[model samples]
Target chain A: MYSTTYHRPATVDEAVALFAKGSDAKYLAGGHTLLPVMKQRLAAPSDVIDIARIPTLIGIEASSETLTIKAATTYFDILSSADVKRTIPAIAHLTSVLGDPAVRYRGTIGGSVATNDPTADYPAAVLALNATVKTNRREIPADAFFQGLFTTALENDEIITAIAFPIPEKAGYAKMRNPASRFALTAVFVAKLKSGEIRVTATGASQDGVMRVPVIEQALAANWSAAALEGITISEEGLMADIHGTSDYRANLIKVMAQRAVAAAG
Target chain B: MANVQLTVNGKAVSADVEDRTLLVQLLRDHLGLTGTHVGCDTSQCGACIVHIDGRAVKSCTTLVGQVDGANITTIEGISKGDELHPMQAAFRDNHGLQCGYCTPGMIMSAIDIVNRYGADLDEDTVRHELEGNICRCTGYHNIVKSVLDAASRMKLSIAAE
Candidate 1:
């Protein structure tokens, strides 16, 4: 929202070049997240590089082993994509319930993942599915991608090009949505990987950001059923608490949503 | 400053705007089309909703530079001469509005719902899809009824065409 030059680049190289020229620059994808922050004066970059129109970052490619999503692909595209539905229906379902319809039409996957909002939906999926985030500079695995709330492994000028999600043997997601913003109050994503590993992650609950629920992962690994998680309890420590929910409540939600996710995965 | 060219409401219009100018500013301020209201400057309320390239998007959240070459359709452009669009007509007949502050956006989003889900939309689908457009007057009952009515009417018109 501040006075800044806007550059619409045709390619990743051009975008990077534009970024290098500006005193401060941010890659503009969907603008759902960046524009709002800028409008509020929380951020004022000298230049905005519009990478949403770049042809290389605009489609979904689903293969037997992986589901490759271009960075600028919108949430609506993911929800409506037959390929996404066929390969990772849990992700499609998550996309459907993200923001409202209008938000879905413009908000991009890369934007969400890059912003790395702890309450965002994509981080849980990316982490649980063991995805690889491909950026202009390098590829970062989901494990190393998210650092904390509103933080990622991305450098200041690194532009995410695409995300590669390895097809899971089974995966499902469930979340308790904050009614006003539709952000997750507490959400869980459970995945059974092709390598016989089970990854369970909970978002919007931890102050440290999206984290692996080792208890749920171990339980699902053994029995692979909701019943296996019957007696498990998540500790209230390190969980986030606010007016919406207490740490105890979120810890409880972590257990319940993880069970639901596992059941849905089946 | 930026040079923005858009096909707004079917009119090819060009404007010299600030780089930070929102699309809603272009319609309401630059073009004098005030039907697209900005209820909440943030993206929470859908009063600024409009069809950009035939998809419903929040105009306030969208920058003019972001949609330089796009086709935009706001509430004022939906009608033909004095005739109301079926969605607008349905809202009137069903009493879908109270203060009518959210009517334009509601009508725009409703048309998008019908376009995506088709004429066979049920009550739950209409209610769920209406999540973006909030009617502060608490008139969603009539709004839902209006969307269903419009879907049926639009179906008949499509068949007739």
Candidate 2:
């Protein structure tokens, strides 16, 4: 990692002020992604604002209608949160399988959502659950937040404060993980909202980042059964192709994982 | 440079380090705590796993400035004087390691597993949780046994206390 200035701001306002001062400043949450990128000399920000210490950005709050998670909240915290387990166990389960024990300890939800890695676990949950990403400036719906692979709608110096997830009636996440990195080769998150809306989102398999599978969503909305997706086939047009799996393979995984996710949710 | 003051293995230490200095670099190069090894350094290998504020984290990926006021515990801190931690003893008894390069990280992660799951941990659970720490030597059979043994021993010790 190159030489840089680190600022630990006590509050969100201070953090924003510190960030605005530097020409090239990045908000440091868990540093799982940012630090590794820096060490590889892929990025060289002049200043790093450590938002992990900001008290306002470090908790999980559950209300009657929604679950609000601070941006800096770690995966371990989510896994251990009684509120999360009680209200949205699918999210807790997703957090459990994300990365590993150590990575979950330090990797933050904010960093994961902000980075929007194509294979990341949280984006699928965010999209399927219809969560709202609250930033310092404005709130972006999950549908609008993710722009593309490793990209988000976040602007320069914009900081994510928290994400509000509507508690679905039932939800489940099924992932086929890469043996080495543990990143999802193909993962699907299915949610049946209290309003009887069924949303299906797939991650890691999409070239455009986490995306909604309209066909599966439409089928599940009608029947809410794995067999409902029997004849529906996912086109390989926009799926990611890499060493782990081909676009054709991922297209098949989308259907398979969706079935598994539905079964798990039931 | 950033002024970082942290408690390591019950000892409070302060240092001025570059903002980009990794926690593993601070421990190994500055504080002379070489127990934390850097294997992959890409956060894939858990060789640099250590406890910061009672949580296991990859030290290689964490910046020194990020843990300024936190409490850290490395492999060296697990033993009590001359006595090995139950996890360490279990590794020896079960022959959990061979080359010993990944031993420190394995032990650290094992202790954490036991701390979270307690004595009733199952073999499958131990295997699943050991994903962060990779052991090329033992093929994980002995390592899994070692963690189970350590969890049982640790539980018994806790009961006695």
Candidate 3:
């Protein structure tokens, strides 16, 4: 890794100031993604501002209508959270399947959401749950948060503070892991709100990153059951096809995963 | 350079390392504690697993600056003077290792698995929890057996206490 200046700031304002002073600065959260990329010479930031210890960014708050998770909260904490498990067990279950035990202890929710890796698990949850990304400056809706793979609505200096997930009537997640990296090969999250609106999102299978599946959502809206998706199929176009699986296979898998997710939600 | 102060293996140690220095480098190089190995720098293989603040983490991917004042425990710290930790003894008795390159990490990770899942762990749970630590040898059968055996031993020792 290239040599860089490290700053451990106490507050978000201090962290923002440090970022403004340095050229090509990066906020260091869990360092799971940043450190590995830096080691491979993919990212060389002149300054790394450690925001993992910021007191304001480490917690989980559940209200009557929403469950707000601080950005710096680790996956382990999320999985172990009684409130998260009780309120949205699907989110907790999603956290359990993310990475391994060692990685879960260190990796943070903010880091994962900000990195916005297409194969990441959080995006599917965020999009399906209609969560809001609260940053130091503004709140970005989930629909506007993830723009593309490794791309988000966050500015360079903007640090995510927390993500507020609205409590849904019912929700569930199902994914096919890559086996090696354990990242979602083709994952789907199904959520039904109190008002009877259904939201379906799939990650790791789309070429454009996490995307809402209208056809499956429409099918589920008509009849909320796995049987509703009997003959439904997602087009192979714009889906990821690599050594892991072909585009057609992913398209077929999406329907199957959506059905499973719906069944889980039930 | 970054000034890192850590409580490692129950001893307070301070080091002046670069901002990019990994925790494994600090343990293996600066402190001369070579038990923590770095089999894969990319964080794939769990050769660099260590307990930071009672939780198992990949020391290779962790920057020294990130865990400045944290308490750390390496493979060298798990035992008494001569007696082995129950998990380590279980590995030996079960012949859980071959080539021994991944032993330190596997043991560290195994202890953590017991810590979280407790004495009532199943085979599938053990195999799932061992996802981060990769052992090319032993096919992980003995390693799984070792972890199960250690869990039982740990339970027995806890009961004795």
Candidate 4:
């Protein structure tokens, strides 16, 4: 790794100040993803402001209506949390499936979401559940949060503090992992609307990050069945064609996995 | 290099290390607790797994300064010198190691698993939890069995206490 000045700030203000002091300064959450990339020479920040120590950035509060997770909340905390399992087991299950115990123990949901890896599972859940991402500057809706690959609504100096998701009537997430990194080659998140509108968000297969599969949603809205996604053609017009899966294979998986997700949700 | 102080293995340690100093480096070079192996240069391998404030974490990826006030327990801290930890004993009894490169991480992670899930864990759960740590040796069959055995033993031990 290239040399960089490391600052372990106790408060967000101090962290942000440190961040503002340097052009290439980055907030280090769990460092599960950031450190690896830096070590691999994929990214070399001039400074790293450690945010794990800020108490304001640490919390996992669940109420009767919604669950709010602070950015510093580790993936293992989500998986081991009783409130998460009771309210949104799918999110907890998402953490359980990410990497292994060591990574989950060190990786935070906020890091995964902010990194916005197309293959990561949290973004799919965020969009499907209509979660709100609270940055230092603004609360961004999931609809407007993800822009494209390795992109989000977050600005250069903006710091994310928390993410909130409303308790849905029912939801499920499923993915066909790449087997090597265990990242999704194709994943689908299905959420049931009390008004009978089904929202289907597709990840890992999208060329522009994650996109809603309108046809699958429309078919599910018309007929809530595994067969609803059968004839619905999910196009891979600009989807990512990776070594693990061709664009066509991913496009087909969008349909099959959406069907499986709908079935799983049901 | 910056002056730093932290609690490692339940003792206060102070050192003058560079800003680029990683926790693994602090443990190995400064403190001389070299049991935590650095298997993968990246964070993929859990060969550097250790407990920071009682949570399992990859020391290799974490900066030593981040763990200033945290309680850290490594593989060297697990056993009581003469007597092996139940997980270590289980790994030994079950032939859970061959090259033994990943043993420390596997054992550390297994201890964390048993602490969280108890002894009733199924085979699939063990496999799922061990995903972060890679082992080219032993095919993970014996490692999984070792974890299951350790889980049982630790559960009893925790219950007895």
lDDT of 2 by residue, A1-266 (tens): 78889988899999889988998999999888899999999999999999986888999999989999999998889999999999999999899899999999888999899999999999999999999999999999998999998889999889999999999999999999987788999999999999888899999998888999999999998899889988998999989888888999999999999999999899
Candidate 2 collision pairs? none
lDDT of 2 at B27: 98
State the fnat of candidate 4 relative to the true structure.
0.84
TM-score of chain A, all candidates: 0.98, 0.98, 0.98, 0.96
Q: What overall lDDT, based on C-alpha atoms, would model 2 receive against the true structure?
A: 0.92
True contacts kept of 3: 0.90
lDDT of 4: 0.84
Clash counts per candidate, in order, are: 0, 0, 0, 2
* Colliding pairs, model 1: none
Show model 2 residue runs off by greater than 4 Å. none
Residue-by-residue lDDT tens digits, candidate 3, A158-195: 99999999999999999999877889999999999877
Please give, for residues A130-160, the per-residue lDDT of candidate 4 as tens digits: 8899988889999999999989989877788
Clash pairs (backbone) in predicted model 4: A100-B132, A207-A239
Worst 10 residues of 4 chain A by lDDT: A191-200
lDDT score, candidate 2, position B34:
97
Q: Which candidate has the top score in DockQ? A: 3
Cα lDDT tens digits for candidate 2, B1-161: 87999999999999988888999999999999999999988898799999998888899999888888899999999899999999999999999889999989988988899999889999999999989988777459998999999999999999999
Would you list the C-alpha lDDT of every candidate in the order shown?
Answer: 0.93, 0.92, 0.93, 0.84
